[model samples]
Target chain A: MKISCVTTFLMCGNFDNTLAHNLFYVNMETPTQFISRIISNDRISEGFFELSLSWDPRAPVPMPGQFMTVRVGSLAVPLLRRPFAFAGFDADSSSAAIIYQKRGAGTELLAAARPGDELDVIGPLGTPFVIDTDQSKHVIIAGGIGLGPMLFLSSALKSRNIPARFIFGCRNKSLVPDTKMFTDADPQICTDDGSAGFRGTVADYINTNVSLDNSTTIYACGPSPMLTSVNKIAQSSGARCQVSLEAVMACGVGACMGCAVPVVGGGYARVCKEGPVFDGGEVLWERM
Target chain B: MGANVDLSVRIGNGTLANPVGVASGTFGYGGEYEGLVDFSDIGAIYTKAVTLEPRGGNAPPRLVETPSGILNSIGLANVGVEKFISDKLPYLRTLPCAVVVNVAGASEDEYRRVVERLESGCLDSVDTNGSGIFGYEVNVSCPNVHHGGLAFGTDPAQVERLTSSLRELTKRPLIIKLTPNVTDIAVVAKAAEAGGADAVSLINTLVGMVIDVKTRKPVLGAKTGGLSGPAVRPVGVALTCKARRAVSIPIIGMGGISCADDALQYILAGASAVQIGTANFVNPKTAGLVSSGIREYCIGNGISSLKEICGVAVD
Candidate 1:
């Protein structure tokens, strides 16, 4: 009933897809918050770091495209939790990892973290990526720091015995994550400077080289302009596209009403709750 | 277990089971933290401010983390009065904690109308026997909205009239949330009490600005937002004490209260109760921790009731 009003108010008398609404908003399972010990903290590349933590056995294992918020400090400054998408998850070991860039104060604090350090984490949060069983092919795209969830999605597709084309974009070879970290799902690297596997942007290569059709599904996580371009490409080829978003988040829960992004419709949706992953068609590219 | 220590606080006709509460805006309508935070330990839940109509809120980048706080310009985004009764109120009714409806509006009549609807419409469904809507926290202090937020709070006369008008509407506690952005918050507190307000909560966020160097643009879509968390704790404590000095009504204090020790600063300075604000985003268990910690402090110090410490730290 609460969700109905929230959904009704957010719906601008223009929604035609209840399936998408249910998949993204309704029937949400509550998230769990717990203290997890850091298993490993490593700088896997220049400007990129990966911190792995033990997952709470009682909570549901975070699926591909889902994110978590880590309490960087116990005090007031750096007051809000830092949100990170799950880059990798090992079910048997009951562990999860986030590949982050050491850019701000939050990640800087996170970089100093060591093995066995207790970290407060809330997770298996937001809407997870929905994989279709009948799609003939999948295309996974990740850009720099956005590699976190895309990396997880690539592995998810592989486990289901699905074939996919993986492309990861970076400014240069140094900014790219180590190939060893992505052993589970091999990705074709595309650097702006042509210092890696393929030259030019990920969208550039896909527009020129990759063939898309109704049978193909495109999954992406990247900067806004790149996503806008990818969505255009997918739309032109009649391929369904899902783009994972990144935003400065405060509660990471639905409460704060921060981390809002405009959808294709008139109203705004909480990226922390309604999604980090939104269908490309539902996105307002011009607004971004 | 310090069960003998009386943690409850009386505000007008309503009584808070304990003194620790999650501030409005930070706790949503109490549904967001259901599974995450233990609600049984919470004394009250001040829900997100409800306006006359649904608000879309500010655009993206509504929040930013500062040194020890968060700057937010959520623009009082909410589900409105109708949805509040139909959607939010039911879930809040089920919570063990006291529910305080935080009301905000663009005009005086809007505020009155919302209060009127809530009091009249919720007569039958409210679990007053249990812990239902015990009171209304008037949010004239919200800095994010353009009209009827800071505009109404900054003026003492406006606050007084607003308080009295709403005061005449219901028998429940009426807490006027004071904004620290004002030059003299005590003046407003005195007005609220003079207008027959049951209690007043202080202090709302201080106006702050953050600029991005690269883009040469403001971090928030709204040029400025309200600052909460530890950054404003000292300001909140100081203003809260000033209001305490001027008014006899119970004062509910909040700023960057992350734990009980911080809450004690307000309590000692004269606050009867305290609300956990930005810290809720950091740790949802802060209410439980703060309430328990306050209990221990009371027991250790041989303090039987909150009256023993409140107003001890005089100006």
Candidate 2:
């Protein structure tokens, strides 16, 4: 049914506000959040930087594992918006935290954000990692900044008293955030170069410690290869798994067909609409 | 007055607020541009073309950014007629300005049904100037999908059949959108008028392609797509002029109109109004710019109202 009434207000000509009714307006009405200041902007790898942000609510609160559209340059040319998953959103009594990696113009601009600068953001869009109730144990697989979305998903799951295990993967130990939020969990970390943490891929960590039949559910967000590998293990082990799919999006809302993912059933579905989150089985991963 | 000219004109049964309306498919319904483009400033917002059924659209790689344009083969993926009426239409009613819904039909009956259904609402208004609710821009020129877009637009007789069929359903004005892929756009424009169309929009996305040299394959999953953006503006202007001479009814010109200057060129070339497509991808604020630019041009030229520029050309 249509909502009793729809209300609209234009913040300005530059900023975009998404309004929808019925299935179009899903959970988390105000999802995208922006940063108030930069906490750290140190470089991690050759071109990547491990950046942290203090969240501002005027910016919508990003759902765990959701991404935002960050504008990069002062130039009007090359005006398409890029999508990035939230690294984390752990709120304290006074503030919140988010992490991202510098990749392209959007990220480069995000990296240049100073100690007192603000960024235009739209958020908590797409289906977030579902915390499954059917399983008593949970496993997380992360790769690169794909680890970003997992951080917040982990925090949300842990606060609910859900027993969780994490497998963080990156090329070197320097890439992993200083400390995984759930310190008590002693989550597993893997580095391709053995520079730190477990000296192997996160998939290897899962292979050694996880038994699919252990009342387990898997939540994963990372590089496509890592997710594909994790998906295989989760499937064979009979564990229900949800994977976050990433795409280049124009409008975070379903208006633009720029960010579409192929489904197993037939036809294309919007990553911003049907889901950035999908059952491992429901997606035709190979086709995409 | 030498370099400036007013840019508004009459379209069907209504006088537009301006002459730079948002084109179908690009704007994705009016609300998409709510805060990005001032809803009340532009002439009208022609929503994304809606079909009888909700389409899932084509697979991955639907859009590609070219030098100054974008090649998109989105396939008109929308929420079906039922969802649009029950969900999309009500929100459109709330907009502060006129809202014209672009309709895409795969068959004659579907075309009639959509027009018949829309006419039942407040869309039946006639302003003091005589044109209101504006009208329906039957999108026969969309090249993105295979179903019905270019399917009917390419054949003049079929285009005539669809136009006349819709004209019979409602007296609320009908604008048939024509494709530029044809040998002669004016032939199709005349066919549309012969079928009783009140107006027509020229030059939907031009069929084009992009390639990934590394993989040695087409960039879009569909392999080929429609090219839009500044790349197609000249083609659109030429065709809009040709169609204007062939048909007595007003013509809505479109194809890569990103700025006010681009929009004005279409007006001077004989377009009653112009539609801005690919520009929305580059700047969501484009519609507002074109609208204000027209007004600014009008005031600078001592043009009292937008009506004077309807078909004023160099000749």
Candidate 3:
């Protein structure tokens, strides 16, 4: 624990001074850590799984783009908790879900999580995506497992009667999440191998199909390369963009400056604190 | 009768209410852990290392998850001494626990200036004398930094010289944070003691690295980082024990400590105090829980003070 990234360590300074930042997390009173029983842990597709857990209703309901760090195991072999954005949060059921791809030791352990088993969770943490008032043509894009938060955002947008051009990109048809929830989003599927809708990457689809304008707002989540591409596409179109980034975090809270992502400014930003979401132009893409 | 069991221990001229404290980098500036951890249960909160100027730290991929632990090359990225005074100190000043600013720098002058700025900068904001800035934890053992971190820590003369020089700037407490990547940890412990240090904190992270087989590249941007967590507990406990016999000054023990029992291992090995490090990432309330568990163990065993159990296992 003698480690420290001597950056602008957080308290009030991590998050930006935007209205959305204040609206969502301003009085996040009594951040609670709880143990929830796994309601279900089901594989939705090849190398992809969905975990649902009972929630402590006392804790604030997680907004779209918000994330939780789940303790996948009791022991230290898989040392740090895996931070996953909320794929779903149902206050009525008092449960939440995470859609994760089985990649590392942590998710591999999470894949084996069974119903009736208990897991520790700390959340509704980080800045949530804001529904801007200008009514810009909203475009929500998800790449592979990045679909988790974007899917949550789409449903929330629909409930608010906010329509968006939804796109989900993956390697092929087999990589797609096989869930009723995914189908509910009514997303345009783009596949690399032409096994689905539009052929090639999400960048290719944006370049060939969608015509963006200054009034456009791009909201995205996915791998770094895809996010970098989104940043570029939005930049060229002069569209405002808020990207949800995925970074490895030792401490899910702002405490550990381990989850740093390079921004346009001089110093690095802790992705766990300042964002899993940031302005497209704010990030220094070349460094990423 | 168990209610009267005392857990108070010494950290120099000042008394630590308990032996449970959070490590430097893991705890950040204490305010970062607002709603999650109860500050009342902790004995100390070692703030992140502060330098003369702000540090951008290493490149991305600063952290990598190793088995039972983590490897980090954060490179001491901090908001500099000026910002630490302006931004981080206010919240740290209000914490119920003791606040120890962990200081790091590339050169000896940078370290001196950082402490000097803190000594003078905290005057108007603080009401109680020297209460806002509790003490200093000189981070001579940080392995990730290319400059004065482990370099100063590994040499006995440099440790002694730096400790005594910084000793002149403050009277509160000077705890030299030591690294384990050395041939002899005791010589360094004795070096701090010889330099008029109030206490010594042992076993900063051991230098380690992780590689991605597919890419054939190092996982961390710095290529090598310090390893901490349960993986380093034995190394920490062993070093804590070694330093205890070498120096009479209080020994603050840390490394891979997650539980009260893990802390107890250090206390039995002669650590006057213990810190919860990587475990904070797993659970923020770990220090408080560890405190409670340690108290319960003391009461159940009919031990009057934690000092009785300190270093009991060594003989």
Candidate 4:
């Protein structure tokens, strides 16, 4: 399936141009703090959960690959906001879903949050995936909870009837999210322990089954090592790739300069502003 | 009932509308938080460090979280003073509140050049009165740099020389930002006072580092970074108290100031005004929150003015 250029513009509305402009420029979006109520916070897998938040209808629609910074505790114990990518959004319900892994104190607090609880969130922030109309295929590769942004991107592409594929990987079967949650595309699941689908890493699956062509555009979000490998593969194959990065962020806004990611050239880019999503070639993974 | 309480503060030659202003490097040029925070309610906006030339800053992983604090090695990433004057100052001049530019450099000459540029009216065409920079918060405490920053801040002789030199260059309120990394913060504060600094602000982030046990390497690209947040608040308060006793000049206190109570604590420790630093990152509206918190504290205590409460705790 493929979406027409006209249809894409119509779907994006007047904000299409502004959104497109923000992708290349840093600190374009004026981040607003929203008191979103938790519609649901359910544990989907061990040490991982999918949280749905009902936000203001007037708030800007979150784009794929963009993230939200969630304040974990009411007090100052966990003083920083944990950045989580948008896993999905239900426009009809005026809600967005974030899939997170319990990695530290912040995520542990986030896991304890109950339904109907209000959370201080700032987002729909960072750069989103830039889908080139010329690209014939959209390949989404995700590792573990990195599936958060990929899920949203896949859902958005499916709405446009854009041809896309999902390559999901996890350490084992238990770590994998329910396949039913991903209804848009039949995911090619890979597990390191061979407890699930294809044995070995997502890179192995991509190496064996996936062939990178000129028209192929790959979008990946995962561990740094996986992203580095993906970038290498895309560069060698002459295919374009965009990767969403993760870092410890203070203000999800551009002001903090807390989440700086090294650029391929010289200088650094803020993961919260310049990108959560950056061209794979543009990132300096070796430095990170 | 709390609305009538006075939050204004005297810092150098000007009066801050409130005692709550964000510290440098935390609030990026004041325009970044336009919609999120009410500028009118803020006493002042301290812009990110501006240098003589544009600095790209350090490598990746410029910041990390430790305990209740954050370690950052941004390396003073900023547009040169020229760009700030041409592009950023116009917007800053339009704001109703006071604008304080935090200036950093590798040498005294660079600092002088930046001060001269500001004083020459090159950046103040918008504000018929003068440049938008109401004051100069000379950042002598930045740990990320090699030659000038912490070096100037830690040594009394360098602090005296830098402060006295800049004092001759501009009449703008010179607030020498002091580093707590020094052996004795009071000595450095006294040096600034003797060198004719109008006021002093302490303490900048404490130099610290975090190591990744797995990689057996430093977490920050710079190997070490300055620590700021709630974890450093006690150290800030203690240094402010010590510096207050050492210098007669007005003191601006900052360090993990998260609430109004924290601001009040600084005032009582002899700070005429307080700069909200790391708190701004955790809560963008912290300055406003701290301002209101001060008001509420005053009303609750029947304190008519901040002057009455300032240094009340000191003997």
Interface RMSD of candidate number 2 = 3.3
Predicted complex 3: DockQ: 0.70
**Model 3: residues with Cα > 4 Å off, grouped in runs:** A1-21, A24-30, B1-3, B123-131
Clashing pairs in 4: none
Question: For every candidate, what is the interface RMSD in angstroms?
Answer: 1.1, 3.3, 1.1, 1.5
lDDT of 3 by residue, B56-114 (tens): 88998999988888999888988899999999998887888888899998888988999
Query: How large an RMSD does model 2 have?
Result: 6.5
- Residue B190 shift from truth in candidate 4, angstroms: 1.4
lDDT of 4 by residue, B29-52 (tens): 777787778887778888898899
For candidate 2, lDDT tens digit of each residue in A1-288?
111111111111111223322213533354433434556666545455555556664544455656666555434334565666766554442234445666655577766667556655455566566556557778877787676677777766656566688877889856756543525336677899988888889888788866776378888887788888888888888888888888766666667777787778777777775678778888777776
User: Per-residue lDDT of B1-315 in model 1, one digit per residue for the tens?
Assistant: 535899889898777879999999999998988799889899899999999899989877798878887889999989999999999998888888888999999999999999999999876543333357888999989999889999999999999999999988888889999998877888999999988998999899999999999999999999899988888899988988898899999999999898899999999999999999988888889999999999999998888999889989984
Stretches of candidate 2 off by over 4 Å are A1-42, A51-56, A74-77, A89-120, A132-135, A155-163, A170-187, A191-201, B1-8, B31-38, B117-134, B241-246, B309-313
lDDT of 4 by residue, A1-288 (tens): 011232253244333555455444433546678799999998888899989999677566677888888788867678777788998877678899999889888988889989999998877787778766568878999998798889888877776677788999999989877645664557888999999999999999989999997788999999999999988889988889999999877777777676888786787888888789898988888887
lDDT of candidate model 1 versus the reference: 0.86
User: What would the TM-scores of all predictions be?
Assistant: 0.94, 0.81, 0.94, 0.94
What is residue B154's positional error in candidate 1, in angstroms?
Answer: 0.8
Residues forming the 10-long window of minimal summed lDDT in candidate 2 chain A: A3-12
Best first by DockQ, ranked:
1, 3, 4, 2
When just chain B is superposed on the true chain B, each candidate scores a TM-score of 0.97, 0.91, 0.97, 0.96
Interface RMSD against the true structure, candidate 1: 1.1
